[model samples]
Target: MKSTHFLFLLGLLAACNSQPKDKEKETEAKAEQPASHEPTVNCYQYATATDTVRLTLVHVGDNINGMLIYQLKEKDRNVGSINGTMNGDILLADYTFKSEGTQSTRQVAFKKAGNAFIEGYGESAEVNGVEKFKNVDSIVFSSSMKLEEIPCK
Candidate 1:
């Protein structure tokens, strides 16, 4: 009887010791891994009373890269190719475009709203007798200038 009881105890210890290896194998089989491809692009468009703008953005882990096209009705306009970084709800980009048959670069920013975007307007200054927005962000966008998002074009 003593030998029988000792064999049963030994078998119980062996079973308990082997359970953890099985658990480790299960965990290894179920571990989650990161995706192998980039996400899709997101596009948005808006039209003001006198101008139309379109934006296309690709997001990768909170970073953003996109394009902006601004065209005025029957007037000189800019179609800028922009690359920017996004932080929270704001995107700041350097715009390079041709306007009035001349090429120029400017820094622009956009704030995301619900199904729309609020543009950041800075203070105006005179540079070589031309008024330009400088040090902007003072004027929050009113309801009228809030750009409504249309289908991607």
Candidate 2:
């Protein structure tokens, strides 16, 4: 009877010990795992970009409308052009790019935050001899501005 009880206890210990090895195998499988190659809904949510920008910053008091164009003037740029519709701060342009005189179009995105854009890219240009994207935190077009459409062509 003593030996029977001892054997039963030993069997219980062996069963318990096997549980940990099973768990370790599971853990190792997870640890040596692969990252997610599948796309998730959150990934699409973050990528849902706004189509246009409405200014809410500096002295764009009146309704001014036009297009924006960025050129690779003194650098190595592949393309350039930012032609869009403007309603005060809101711009809806068909941005284009011409590198080596080839043209392609992309929608320009913009948003106004405080004195400047907290997000979005607008065509900062030499408006009236001053670059638009320079020290300006807002767009206040005056007489000196010479609107430069992009792609330089």
Candidate 3:
């Protein structure tokens, strides 16, 4: 009876030890599989006589993230990051930026044209210290600040 119990214990230990190897093999198989899609990056810039804005966008599937920099003459430069989603031809995002050593967050919208993106403007109200559009549907996409596609440097 003792010998029988010892054999059962040894078998349990062996079974437990084998489980990890199976898990490792599964992990290896997953590692060998290719990614479904690679992230695509696009850069754009809007320049005028006194202001210049640069935007770099990276898209991974439906998600988007990017950097935005605003350099306007006589105003503090704002450098920030934006993350949001693309709904149809409209891109809605949250812009978090720093200017004059102060941090601010706001919602931004852009309309995609043939080869450029036009910044949208509308009435906004401060909510929880962040500025958001009063009505997203009412936002006007007629700003002259059009960011033209440029090569990523």
Top lDDT model: 3
Q: Which is the better candidate, 1 or 3, if ranked by lDDT?
A: 3
- Give residue 81's error in model 2 in angstroms: 18
Q: What TM-score would candidate 3 get against the native?
A: 0.75
Worst 10 residues of 2 by lDDT: 39-48
Is 1 or 2 the stronger prediction by lDDT? 1
Candidates in descending TM-score order: 3, 1, 2
lDDT of 1 by residue, 44-117 (tens): 77676777777777777656666777776897777767766776777777667778788777667788887777
Candidate 2's residue-wise lDDT over 1-153, tens digit each?
A: 999999999999999999999999999999899765442110000111322222221122232223333332365344343443345455444455565676655554454323333234445655453334533345343312222212211
Stronger candidate by lDDT (2 vs 3) = 3
Distance from true position, residue 99, model 2, in Å?
21
Cα RMSD, model 1: 6.0
Q: Model 3, poorest ten-residue lDDT window?
A: 34-43
TM values, all candidates: 0.61, 0.30, 0.75
Alpha-carbon runs more than 4 Å astray in model 2: 37-153
Predicted model with the maximum TM-score: 3
lDDT-based ranking: 3, 1, 2
